[model samples]
Target: MYKTIIAVGLGGFIGSVLRYLVSRLTAGVDFASLPLGTLTVNVLGCFVLGLLTGLFERTGNLSPEFRLLLTTGLCGGFTTFSTFMGENFSMARNGQFMLMAAYLIISLALGFVLFFAGYAFSAKIRL
Candidate 1:
């Protein structure tokens, strides 16, 4: 428990710093009204989460502390909504119609549906 807490705290700190750096870099990159940092982080985070999940499943040696570090620490630090909005709008501006449409639909649809499913599953277990 102590290790998990420490791991999560460390991960959160690192994630917060990385998020700040991304925001700063994107701000300087004069690209109309779209945000690049948020989108990049979200996509990257999702990919890493997938990879980590697979790795954990395969290894089966991941401790609770490590899980906290990867899922709660790293991912928690990596995702950003402000950047997502900026990037999405930027895509719209650059006439990447398909990309923008796909991103918007997939992000929202998958996010909501997954959240609901997780919630429902937990509720069932509780009952």
Candidate 2:
């Protein structure tokens, strides 16, 4: 339990840092007059989670602690809902109606699709 906790903590810390760094790097890029940071992190996190899930399954036995570290810790940390919300709100406040709408639609649709695809792929391998 302690090991799992530690692994989660470490992974979360690293993931959060990476997210921040990416956000900073893309801070200058104005995407439809919205923050590109949140979008980048969400998309990257989803892709990484999918890849990691596949790799983890094919590679062999992984301790529960390691799984927790990668899935709950790294992926959870890497994705930023708060930032996403903030960006949406900011867009609305700035009167970027079209951008806000696009962001909301894309985020929801793509997120769901990616999640389902990841789950389906993982399930297929398991079966």
Candidate 3:
């Protein structure tokens, strides 16, 4: 457990640093444009994570540590949006259109609702 935790921490640190670098590099002289930097990283991260997942499945030999380190840590640190998109994309590509659509709808709707709920709850807390 400790090893997995440490691995995730290290991977997360590396991924976050890379994300910051990408953002900085892409933010040059752009104050009124789309967030291309974030989109770029998210898409790229999704592709890489997809590749890793496919590789693991094909090989059928991988440790939980790898998943924790790469998927939960690296991709998550890089951009959780990528992971969410990737999962939906995979389902759609595999002909699980209904599930994909449902997941997307529920995830976005519930995410927004829950986010607002948390914010309101926190604001009301008497601490």
Candidate 4:
């Protein structure tokens, strides 16, 4: 457990730094209301995670710890959106179409609501 935690932490640090660099690099890119930098990272993260998942499955040489470091830690730290997408993809692949649809709807709706709720709560705080 401790080793897994450390692996995740280290991977998270690296992934987070990469995410910051990517965002900074694309900070000036504008595309209407869409956040280009975030979109880039999320898509890239998803692709990378997918590639890693396939590679690991085919190779079957890497340990679970390494997988955790990359998927749950690196990609997770880079963009949780990728993780969310991955979960949905897994569900779809497993033929849980209805569950995936429900999850998709609930996640989007609740995520937006919680985001605004947090923003509103923060605005009311003095310090």
Q: Pick the candidate with the highest lDDT.
A: 2
Q: Which stretches of candidate 4 lie over 4 Å from their true place?
A: 82-127
Give the whole-model CA lDDT for all candidates, comma-separated: 0.69, 0.81, 0.67, 0.70
Give lDDT for model 1.
0.69
| lDDT head-to-head 1 vs 3, winner | 1
Deviation (Å) of 111 in candidate 1: 8.8
lDDT of 1 by residue, 14-115 (tens): 888887887787776643333456655665666666656555655657788888887889888878776667767888898987778877776766555554
Better of 2 and 4 by TM-score: 2
* Stretches > 4 Å off in candidate 1: 30-32, 81-103, 106-127
- What's the ranking of the predictions by lDDT, best on top? 2, 4, 1, 3
Which is superior by lDDT, 1 or 2?
2
Error of 4 at 47 (Å): 0.3
For candidate 2, lDDT tens digit of each residue in 1-127?
7998999998899889988899899988987765678887787777678767776767667888888888788988989989899888888898988989999888877776776577557756643
Model 3: ten consecutive residues of lowest lDDT: 118-127
Instruction: State the lDDT of candidate 4 residue by residue for 1-127, as single tens digits.
Output: 9889988988898889988898899888875423456555665665576556546645667878888998888987887576567767887898988877866665666545544454454444443
What is the Cα-based lDDT of residue 113 in candidate 1?
55
| Native-structure RMSD, model 2 | 3.2
Model 3 has an lDDT value of: 0.67
